[model samples]
Target: MTDLKRVDIYDTTLRDGAQSEDVQFSVEDKLRICRKLDALGVDYIEGGWPGANPKDDAFFARARKELNLSHSRLSAFGSTRRAAARVEEDVVVRGLLSAEVGVITIFGKSWDLHVTQALGISLAQNLELIHDTIRYLKKRVDRVFYDAEHFFDGFAANPDYARQTLEAARDAGADALILCDTNGGSLPSQVGAAVAGLRDLNAVLGIHTHNDSELAVANALAAVEAGCAHVQGTLNGLGERCGNANLISVLPNLILKMGRETSVGEERLPKLSALSRFVNELANRPTQKNQPFVGSSAFAHKGGIHVSAVLKDSRTYEHIRPEQVGNKQRVLVSDQSGRSNLLYKFSELGIELDPKDPRIQTLLEEVKSLELHGYQFDGAEGSLELRARRALGQVPTYFERRGFRVIDERRIREDEDDDRFMGAEGTVKILIGGVMEHIVAEGAGPVDALHNALTLVLSRHYPSLGEIELADYKVRILMGSGSMSGGADAIVRVLIEWNDGERRWGTVGVSDHIIAASYDAMVEALEYKLFLDKVRPV
Candidate 1:
């Protein structure tokens, strides 16, 4: 085997990723992500465009004092001086300098269409801009990277002018010449061919791609195979339009698949999944379950035969061990699960049972029946564990529910142009240790009211029940074969996530009435908490 080529990982999530729709990073958000990127061992972290906005300006101002990065060098991104402007006096150039960063990446128009139509400048004038901007920045910063914006389209439009543009940057002491698929319309073949054509250049070559064609990662790999040494992308593929290349996906493919080395060495690779979720949490976005390598479902196995084989040898279905990237193997239990699936899931939940135990078969059949009725246990392992323990006669009854009532009220305000206000209240009666406890509470919705009432009654006996906060609530309506014709009485499935400071678990319930389903899920979540704590029935 040949020695792996070392590639530089340049992250632009703070700048380009923040441009995604509904994504706006505060100065604090940018600073927090910078520290994460540094710990992940990325070669460079591209801070946002200084002076472009108040948030970015504040971030750079604060970063100079606060960010004591150990591995990554911070970079400031901007564009060339405007047409008919002096490089020294240009406001954008000055903004880049005021950032006080070691590296500066500046993009210039490479497409003839943009130069003539967008900027309305002569071809010779465009070349001069690329040369002068790069030269001026190189003299000031430790390194200057020239991003050839729309280079693929530019090359297809006028190859001679495109080469002249790159030559201008190369001759002006630019450290790296990055080819950008700005429009994200180029095929992998086109990107590889373009990079292969530029192999004769003296400066280091780089690849920056977008996902308009859903080929951002593919195009990046293509460029690397064609001799590019630097790869630029966002962390979760977050950016404008379809988004930029996903470094999370690209990094694993480079190291594990292509045998390439990156600054994210073997030791840091295990933290990849946490880093991916950290960004998603800060962005207030749910992690994409199917995202390659670092996603929750990246290594999850569901099929019965697939699970049966993977139990013996994970290589039968898994491409790489999930632990290599900090993800774990998950065996999902559904209607299609076999004996092996149940055994695997039981072991995962720490429920030990012999392979010949008849209760295992009974639990499997019960799971199949429940799944047929719309109770999905794959995402609600806490509920599944409770069911398994109950079947084994290990779980004791904690409390008996006497009854509950929920009342929803709506009022129309006449002076407010018929605005309707809604409120809900719930009353719960439970028998705990032969003592009847009655509780009442009001909440924004029926489920919330019931949860409040139930917890108020239970917390007196089990104080930790009050500490289990509801982290997430998801409701899915099952239609077609299960319910009434018009969907009025369709079966609703409620999945509730609960967290108690350290651990989180999910429980599922299904019923025709939404309130009933929510109650079942809430009760199960509390029961699971008690089960984990080994709380004895009072």
Candidate 2:
């Protein structure tokens, strides 16, 4: 039997991770995320550099009192003292010591290039900075980890000197020696070889990688297989450049693929994607659709053959089950979809549509025809359900729009003496449910006016339906057609969101015309809420 050892996962999402470009989290945000990470069962949480910035300092000071982290030991991170100062006298060291945390992590220059260029110090002085700092911190805390910044490149350049630095930290009683890919350009093969070389060292070995080369997770795993017992990373891969290793991706791979156990609870694996999106939303950054196990499209299927095969056995198309990492399989509807795909989707939604039913065939043909005209229902579940209900003659009683018009005008007054100039008024008309709910609203643009007019009419009947917010909107123009075609065919997809009392869910719509696409998605968003109300009877 292969002896599976347990590994420690240290999360630095609040420190090195917050350095990600444009990722600035307030102290309150940091505390909230830390609490979530603690509940998720990470072994260690590196709060921040308390001495470097007020925000980080405030987080550590406040988090210690308010947040009760049960499974995680809150760690304070910083650099070793300057070459000339003693460890106890340095401001950085003093700040860490004052934080009253049980664990402290300090980084020092291991690469000769950083010593020569960045620090302007001799290699011996740099070694002293690492050794003396660790020795001093050991006196104050039970655990002290030394992050060897740029260790791999340093080893490649000066094997003897780099090994000497690790020896110094080990001798000084540093608990762990973490090899950092500070530049994020190291390959997996190189990482494996380097960790293998350090296997015989007395100290515990760890890895800290970045994603500049898009290989942070791969490199960290390679280090683990090569014998490193600990992994350091940030939640959702947040970090300085590119990002730090994604603990979200790394944890499951360790547990499921490598047979290694972690302090993290098994149930928390499924919440990874939701937690990732929650952090991204709080940070005001767009989540990547293709991000490894936890992204929305990670297990989504669209092609006919793939979907059919997946229905037979998900392993045919999926590397790992979606539920293993808190995600679900999505069967997308597109021009490439087959009858089996539609039937499967309908069944999953609990809509009993028999394959032999004439109405089912009609709906299938209508969907395919609409797809050819640039309507994509794959991302629009609510819209597809609404279409299915309408085809089956089961739509709810909705008010009819007899006619509607939108007029957008903008006027600018220059110098008070000259007459104001007026922008052209844009207008649109539509009829809904045989009712004449005529609305003439003005806006800065035509699209705005049209959206306002529709909302004005729909709000009357669905008074409880909250505001429809656009989460994501994408536009793609296909230009391969011949010059004779007046304009390139356009495809617009929009994700609309609605908030109930408890939570919010998004629905999508796609169309050839931009306005129609937005409108279709908006209607679907409202319809989904309506359907949920009936099903759950809220």
TM per candidate comes to: 0.65, 0.64
**Cα error of candidate 2 at position 191, Å:** 0.6
Clashing pairs in 2: 270-326, 400-432, 400-433, 401-432, 402-435, 402-436
> Where in model 1 is the C-alpha error above 4 Å?
1-4, 334-538
In TM-score terms, candidate 2 sits at 0.64
Badly placed stretches (over 4 Å) of model 2 are 1-4, 334-538
Q: Highest lDDT, which number?
A: 1
- lDDT, residue 183, candidate 2: 92
Q: Give per-residue CA lDDT, model 1, range 1-538, as digits (tens).
A: 1122989999999999999997776665677688779988999999989979888888899889878899999999999998879999999999999999989999999899999999999999998899999999998889999999999999999988888889999999998889999999999999999999988876689999999999999999999999899999998999999999999889989999998989898667776876786676556566788999987688788888998998899899999987777677778763232576567657767899999999988998998889778777644768999999999998898998888999998866445666477779999999999999999998878988999999998999999898888766767776554343455567777877677876667788998888899899998998999999999999
Give a tens-digit lDDT track for model 2, residues 1-538.
1122878899999888898888887776677678678868888899998888888888888877777778889999989899878777998899999888989999988889999999999999988999999999999998999999999999899978888889889999998899999999999999999999987776788899999999999999999998888899998899997899999899989888888878885767765765786677556566688888988688889898998999789999999988777677878874233465577657746799768888987898998777655455543456777888888977765543333334434466555654454433323343445555565555445545655566665566555554554433434343222343466665555544445644345555555555566556655666666666663211
Superposition TM-score, candidate 1 onto the true structure: 0.65
**Clashes in model 1: which pairs?**
none
